[model samples]
Target: GVTRSHSRPKVSNDNPYSEAHFKTTKYMSDYPERFDSLAHAREWFDAFISYYNHEHRHSGIGLHTPASV
Candidate 1:
């Protein structure tokens, strides 16, 4: 197998930040179990985006919302 020097060490975790975000999104109380239609899915996503940007405080950016940042 070809190896790259830029690859992360095997001992280190891969993309922990993204993993955490996925977990948070999946675990939110408002996260729907399923969407009824395309429009409904869009509506749900819009609401989630609003909450994530305006309401959720991201610790990665000094505990500030993405909108504030």
Candidate 2:
């Protein structure tokens, strides 16, 4: 329901929420500070999304993967 609203810097002092979510989901406690400079973060984010969509089941989605549902 709540999507990007403030494109202007004045309107939104905080960063865009979707971008923020991506950064949070991609970067976590276990990941290295520097992941091969660039490839590492991208690779990990890809893997994480794959696992989240396919391998990781959620009860909220009737216990089915988001892709499957």
Candidate 3:
């Protein structure tokens, strides 16, 4: 079964966790100003997802990587 968010329309703060992740991605030093192509974007996101799950530590999760949790 899947649950749906009941947040109001046009509410950007409806999901704090996702907002936080977006902030982290935007503020990354290596983040590109613009991806060259769809393939390039995919490659970058694949690497980013790997690092986010395997290397990035979250304080809310007791500083453990998502993969370790």
Candidate 4:
């Protein structure tokens, strides 16, 4: 059960938000340069998601981590 929308009046048109967010994290700001290597990227990404779900403050959740929410 998922729904997404782009610029069309159709049945659940698709937008690329997930891909856009990954690009921002992996390439923008202070992301590591070594992510060009798949193994390194996987390791860092795992660390990031772990911290994200358990440690990071999610503003959209009223400054609570998702685990707390």
Candidate 5:
């Protein structure tokens, strides 16, 4: 089961990593405004995750992809 955070609402500082990732995901030029279907959303996320882990470089990791680190 997924654990729920007990932090107050509207507070994003508790998880800076996820907040940064979400910001990146939303700001992508290819990001869609809406998903046409559940399958579509899943497919999009799969591609995004692949690119994120394998190709995207992170400054926090010295500009290396997560998979390489």
Candidate 6:
């Protein structure tokens, strides 16, 4: 689903965009610091993916949710 950007020469800033998104997920108040079990992790991941795909607005995609995009 990723829209590939025109292939430009690699640079350090290339990673910032993805890294920032990862930081946002990691720093979310509801994100657990630890998971008790595989089941628990799966549950959390499912919920997060649901919200991320259906609700979270991605600025990179013109402020639209991924599901909508």
Deviation of model 6 at 43, angstroms: 0.4
Worst 10 residues of 3 by lDDT: 5-14
Best by TM-score: 5
lDDT of 2 at 41: 79
Q: Estimated TM-score per prediction?
A: 0.68, 0.51, 0.79, 0.56, 0.80, 0.68
Off by over 4 Å in 6: 1-18
lDDT of 2: 0.70
Residue pairs clashing, model 2: none
Give each model's clash number: 0, 0, 0, 0, 0, 0
Among these predicted structures, which one has the highest lDDT?
A: 5
Write model 3 residue lDDT over 1-69, tens digit each, in one string. 988985465685578778789888988888999999999999988999899999999899999999999
**Per-residue lDDT for 1-69 in model 6, tens only?**
889886454775577767767776788779998999999989988888899889988888999998998
Candidate 6, run of 10 with poorest lDDT: 6-15
List where candidate 5 sits over 4 angstroms from the true fold: 1-13
Better of 4 and 5 by TM-score: 5
Give the backbone clash total of model 4. Answer: 0
Write the residue-wise lDDT of candidate 2 on 1-55 in tens digits: 8798644554555667666555656565665766785788788878877877887
**C-alpha local distance difference test of each model:** 0.83, 0.70, 0.88, 0.69, 0.91, 0.83
Task: Please rank every candidate by lDDT, starting with the best.
Answer: 5, 3, 1, 6, 2, 4
- State candidate 3's TM-score: 0.79
Badly placed stretches (over 4 Å) of model 2 are: 1-30
